[model samples]
Structures are given as C-alpha cells and as structure tokens.
Target: MLRLDRVSAGYGRAQVLRDLSLEVKAGEILCLLGRNGAGKSTTMRAIMGLLPLMSGTIWLGERSLSALPAHEVPRAGVGYVPQGRRLFADLTVAQNLEIGLMARQSGPEVREQVLTLFPRLRDRLGQKAQTLSGGEQQMLAMARALCLRPEVLLLDEPTEGLQPSMIAAIREVITALRAEGVAVLLVEQRVDAVLEVADRVAFLENGQGGAVMSAEALRADRGLVDRYVGV
Candidate 1:
C-alpha cells in the first residue's frame, strides 16, 4: 500500500496541502476529486517527491518516501503521469520511452509489455511524439510510466480533452493495473469517469481529504455527489 501519514506540502511560502493523510491500497483505484486550488495536483506532487514535504511522512509499503528526491522517486516504484502529457514532443515514441528505461535499466521484455498495453504505440514507434493525436500521446505517456514497472502509479487529469472512446480505453488500462496489483492514485475531474474504475473516492476541499468513502456509497447518494463534486 502507498500511504501519506498526515503529510503537509507546498510550493515556496504558500502551503497547499494541510495535514493530508490518505492511502492507495494494492489492487485498488483511489480517485481524487477537487475543484481548482483544492490541492489535488499538489498532493500528487508530494507523493511523487516533486514537492518538498513540510511535515509528516509518505510511505510505499515499508519504505519511507517523503525524504526521497524527485528523480529517485521513480526508482522507488512510483510512476507518474502529470497533466498535459509531458512527453518529449520532438522525439520519436521509441526514444521517449527509452528515457523511462534508463531509470531501472529494464530490458526489452519490459518494453514489450508496455508496447503491448498500447498497441497504437507499437505502430507509431518511429513517429515523433508531437505527430500523434492527443489520445495517442496520452497512451505513450502512460506506456512510458509502465515501462518503469512501478508498484504505484499517479495520474493527473488523464481524461482532460479526451473523447469518450479514449476515456474508456484509459479506464481499461487503470482497471488492468489494479488487477495486476498496482496501486493507482488518480487525480481526475470527472466523477463518473473515475467512479467507473475507482474503488474509493476522496474529496479534496480546503486542502484536506478526510472523507474517503467507498465508490458504492458515493454512487448511491445523489446529494453527496452534489455536495462534494459539482463536475
């Protein structure tokens, strides 16, 4: 399991997350929902070691993650897909994926697994990342992360600007990751989209997420959906 033990983090002098504690269990999808400035992205940054921890700790099973540097976090079995599909647009899909292979020096076998996940990538290996469509680029970004063979995956706004078909494909990917016992912490705006794949939901309001509940409960209560998630 991946856990944040009352973690507080921020950028510069402004603190975004305030005493936030949460967990993403193995084989489960924990969706994070929040409005703008709710600190959902900040929370993902804290877990990925991109932001410094102000207080408390983060854990991936028995290992302490709060103190690790950003670059080292990937080797710690944490894969991250930031918003906007941050790929090397000028590079070919194969070259972009090679960057991820450098993290663990993984062989061709692991690379093959990632390619298998997104067959579209297998065909576009020689094409520059910028030439691919939005959905294809997102798939490449995710495939690069999977190339890391991470135990925990953090995704931010994956469905943004995507069509329904692409959203369904990403949903299948997340569900497959869960079935493989890879814990996923998903930061998404679409409640229905996340709920379709998520086991639980956490609402981030005022920089805190204390009310983590089962997806079933959230789905059953229309009022709760109105109160916490307007989108």
Candidate 2:
C-alpha cells in the first residue's frame, strides 16, 4: 500500500501541492484527474522524492519514504514514470532496459520478468530509442520501470501522445499489472478512460484535493466533472 499524509511540495518558493493526501491499496488502480498544472505531476514527483516535501509524510506499506533521496526512493519498492518518457535518444533499447535493471536490488530474475511483458523489446533490442515510434517508446519506458520490480508504480500521463490502439494496449498492460497485485497510481487527462479503469478517483484543483470517490460514482456525477474537470 502507498499513503500520502497531508503532503505538501513545491519548487523554490512556489507551492504546487497544498496538504494533499491520498492512498492506493494493493492490487488497485487509483486515478488522479485534474487540469494542467493542477499538481498531478507534483504529487507524483513528491511521492518519488524527485521533489522535496515541505510538509507531511509519505509511507510505503509500513516504511516511511519521507526522508529518502530521489534515486534511493525506487530501491524502496516505488517505481516512477515521469510525465515525459525520458528515454535516452542515443542509447539502444537494450541499454535503456539495462539501466533500469541496475537500479534493482533483485537478481537477474527481475530482468526476465520485464522481458516477458515486453517481448517486442527483445526483438528490437539493438534499435535506438529515438528511432522507435511514439507508441514503442512509451512501451519501453514502462518496461524499464517494471524492470525494477516495484511493489507500487506511479504513472504520469501514460496515454498521452499516442494513437487509440496504443492506448488500448497500454490499458491491457496496466490491467495485467494490477492482476499481479502491483498497486498503480495513474494520472491522466482522459476522463472516460479513467472512469473505465480506475477503482477510485481523486479530483484535484488548484493545489488542493476536492473529492474522492469510486470510478462509477465519479462517472455518474457530471456536475463535479464540469466544475473541476472542464473539457
């Protein structure tokens, strides 16, 4: 389980999150929905220790992650896929995957697990990341994160800048991850997609959290969506 207790984070002198709090249980997908600059990315960064927390605590299961550094955060069983894919354009696909595996404390068995999910990557292991299509790069990004064998995964805008088919493929992968009991914290702009896949939804506005409800409940409440998540 992952828990954010009244967490507040920001850049130098500019606050992006205001006492935000939320939780994602094991084997569940928790979606964070909001307009651009609503602190969705900030929340993910804070959880991963990419950004320093100004206040409150972040917990992974029974352990506290509030004081860990960014690189050290992932070793604690948290994997982060930032907003951009952040691939190394010069590196081959295999090289990128190798870097991810280096972060893991586990044995070679974890790399085997990642390759099982992204078999396509195995075939194109020698290709440069920049040469791959947008969809393929996205898949590689996800594959790299999974190589760490995280207990909890935080995904930011995973479906952004992709075709419909690619989105569906990624959705299938996420579903499979959940089935394997990996908790996911997903932040996305697609309301319908979030409603379809999320077990629970949290609507964030400005820097504060508004309401937390089940996917079905959020889907049924059109007023709240319009008020906080205008199209």
* Top lDDT model: 1
* Candidate 2 Cα lDDT to native: 0.89
Clashing pairs in 2: none
Question: How would you encode candidate 1's per-residue C-alpha lDDT over 1-231 as one tens digit per residue?
Answer: 999999898989999999998999999999988778889999988998889999989999999998788889899999999999899999999999999888988889999988877888999999999999999999999999998999999999999999999888888898999999999999998887877888999888878875788999988875666676665
Query: Candidate 1: lDDT of 217?
Result: 90
lDDT of 1: 0.90
TM-score between model 1 and native: 0.97
lDDT for 218 in candidate 1 is 86
lDDT of 2 by residue, 190-225 (tens): 888887789998989988988988988877877888
TM-score of each: 0.97, 0.96
**Candidate 1 segments exceeding 4 Å error:** none
